[model samples]
Target: MTSPLNTLPALEKTLQEVEILLAEAEGFDEDRKKLVVLNKAAFLLLVGKFEAYIENLVEEFVFAINSLELRAAHVPERLLAEHSVQIVKNVKDHLNNGKLEKVNSMFIDLSRYWAEIEPCNSLNISNKFSYGKHGEKELIKMFKRCGIESIFDEIVLYDPQEKYDSNEDSVLDIKGIFNSITNMRNNILHQDETPTLTVGNVKYYKNILVQLAECLEELLQKIISNADSKRQKEGMFDYVI
Candidate 1:
């Protein structure tokens, strides 16, 4: 069956292909020295792709929340007020008459304003939420600021105390995992590091990525489902002519 996480199928397939390629590379004797070098390059490429997928997932989640909140409340003043004084004033100016056309125009202006001030879109997720940065605290702050913190906390799976291994008793530090992944990606891209990767390392990283993706998928599904139920309970349609 397809995974509940929509992105998992593609990612899993790619990872499996990488594993096969690595295994084949290992079969070559030392006489074929380039095989090992090629395997390393492939490993780095896999890491790069994994990092990009994570960032894209984060962007999608933030955008979905922002869109839902905007729709549930059509008044741009309330949404943009906290972000920027000028934008609030502009929204007020366009919406002064309160005509349908005026409201529509104000919405257009507000969209531009929101695009400019969106926290996640304006900054890299790592820079915005990494340990030294806001970390989990910043994530909560942003969600609360957007008025979705309650639902976010309810749905997001961020257990800092989770264990990665039962036999070795290795605890999974969520913050450290995020920071380490971000650092590795940055080091590879900026420092041109050819980091060695064994099969064991690939398996471990794959597990981490899978868990992260599943959490994000679950969060997104729950948020949307809850929003739809609320609208239904209130006897509201998605849009009105």
Candidate 2:
């Protein structure tokens, strides 16, 4: 499948051009113009990337939900529709009958699972060799491409501002998590002498990756569930009735 993110090379190129233009500007007036260009470039990047992120998540949801439906059995095709309808109607009842809080809270907790893996600000692993030199960007890219981006979308949707209940367990802040991941990638690229694979460092990165994978899987599952529910609610049930 073609990644939505693949279509943004042109925008990225525009950003690069703007950056170059900003750098070449001289004098206070030109500097102000550069700032505007910089802001516009930033907005364009965020909008393009974030929209792709959501679209990718929706794609994953559709795949998972359809797979599950195909695997389930019913006496007749109409029976399948009826069952799906009941499930969605029940879900809506629960949502209106004081269960929305619990549902939202459950999603929030699932998102928090990613926090179990503490991301290191810098991998102090093996000071002699940089992880980037070892092709760590490939690893990071694999992580996101594999599903981290979708997971990130769920995390954001669950906690748009990172807010939570007063007693809620602290999870990895989305910004912090994203920054740490990016930092690790950068460190690898720059061949920074990070902490070598000491006990703490090894466990940290391993846990981080593991938590990321688990979180992503859970988010994908929830997205699938939501999609299934939406389909059932949208008059797919009428066929059975």
Candidate 3:
């Protein structure tokens, strides 16, 4: 049977591969020969893979959200109202165009219209939700989008002694961590400096990425569990005779 937890193992395996590549590249970097170009190439490969991993994690997160039977009630009223208006306009246009030759045909068209608009509206809402730019401030915004910002109140992951200083009492500086990774990735892609990569730097960022993947996994699991619990409480699985 397939499991949603498969992402964790995939992430772990990718990280292992990155570690091996980095180790080999480090050996080349130490040799200081013409073949040191291999080290630069490996660094580029690592950056590309790491970026892909982050993007895939986000895609999985969006997929998990879409898979859940989340209530549309939580969606903003203004957005829903906008879609409702568009739907009404569509029906009005259909009716005004004098295409209602058959009542049955009109009803069928209406059903099709509703079917088309529902998924579009859901997708629009999902697209509006962002993980934010790679930074601490942006990360806080992302947490708000996830509706788990309050969890930071009790469990501080960034600093234990520093008092929560955000406008909204937040204990975790996850944004900073992500921002650092993003900056390193950008440098690798845009900078012309050759052979600046070190095994230490690669390992450091690799560890951070691993931490991020695990955190995202936990968050996705929590969302699935909460949705399942809610469904169970609602007796959504109850057999109807």
Candidate 4:
């Protein structure tokens, strides 16, 4: 598809995939293998959605730049192809380097691609996020607080002493939760063996995934709202970890 025509439809497709997977995940029974399958599927869908957002941004930028009376070198097409060859290259490099979050890598590419045209659009200098090592003391605290302490045999946190007090009103443990999930996922990933998922483990993982989704949704809402508010702020036109 042409760059301009491809942008919105691709994003819509990704968003649709996210919605479908999230809904399907909601109805998943407490089956270990099924949950694992669903979890991986949902993760892939999310990453695809994020990549689509990055691609759409690149495509839209190209369209906008092409309309302006700028030099050919100034157009995104000169540097970024319609098929996103540069982006795919970076993602490949990141995957080869053992970088886990391809979505963040794609976001970095988006920011860099945008900065070349509009520096103001390069909001975040880096897009990397770390939940730290699993089985750390803080993760233990998180599982304990979340009422699922025994599911994990080990905890590996980056900072053991980091304080993580969940608000009585909130069910999310943003810092520790992701770390715990990543740890479990790594065990299954790195071992080259099938994961032994007990009934308890399945339940715990399902709960963690749900909480993670809610936390992310809430955070995204807050960021979007803040951007809207700032766009209307004193003499400002418009504008995350």
Model 4 sits at a Cα RMSD from the real structure of: 14.7
Better of 2 and 3 by TM-score: 3
On the 0 to 100 scale, the lDDT of residue 79 in model 3 is: 34
Say which prediction, candidate 1 or candidate 4, comes out ahead on lDDT.
1
Better of 2 and 4 by lDDT: 4
Q: Write the per-residue lDDT of candidate 2 for residues 33-120, one digit (tens) a residue.
A: 4544444333333333333333443345344433433222211223233333434555666788889876575444323322322211
- Candidate 1: what lDDT? 0.50
Runs in model 2 deviating more than 4 A are: 1-62, 65-170, 233-241
Between candidates 1 and 2, which one is better according to TM-score?
A: 1
Error of 1 at 44 (Å): 2.3
Each model's lDDT? 0.50, 0.38, 0.50, 0.42
Ranking by TM-score: 3, 1, 4, 2
Tens digits of per-residue lDDT for model 4, 1-241: 1112234445445556555655565666765567656656555444334433533443344343333323223332323343244456567778788886885867665665544432233221111122443333543343222122332342222222234554344444444655655555565556644444443444444444443333333332333344334433433321222
Compared with the true structure, the alpha-carbon lDDT of candidate 3 equals: 0.50
Query: What TM-score does structure 2 among the candidates reach?
Result: 0.31
Please give, for residues 105-162, the per-residue lDDT of candidate 1 as tens digits: 5465546544532221221122123433323454444334333443333532333335
lDDT of 3 by residue, 113-203 (tens): 3443222123222223243234444444444444455323423243333456553454446556556655755565567545455666666
RMSD of each: 8.7, 19.6, 8.2, 14.7
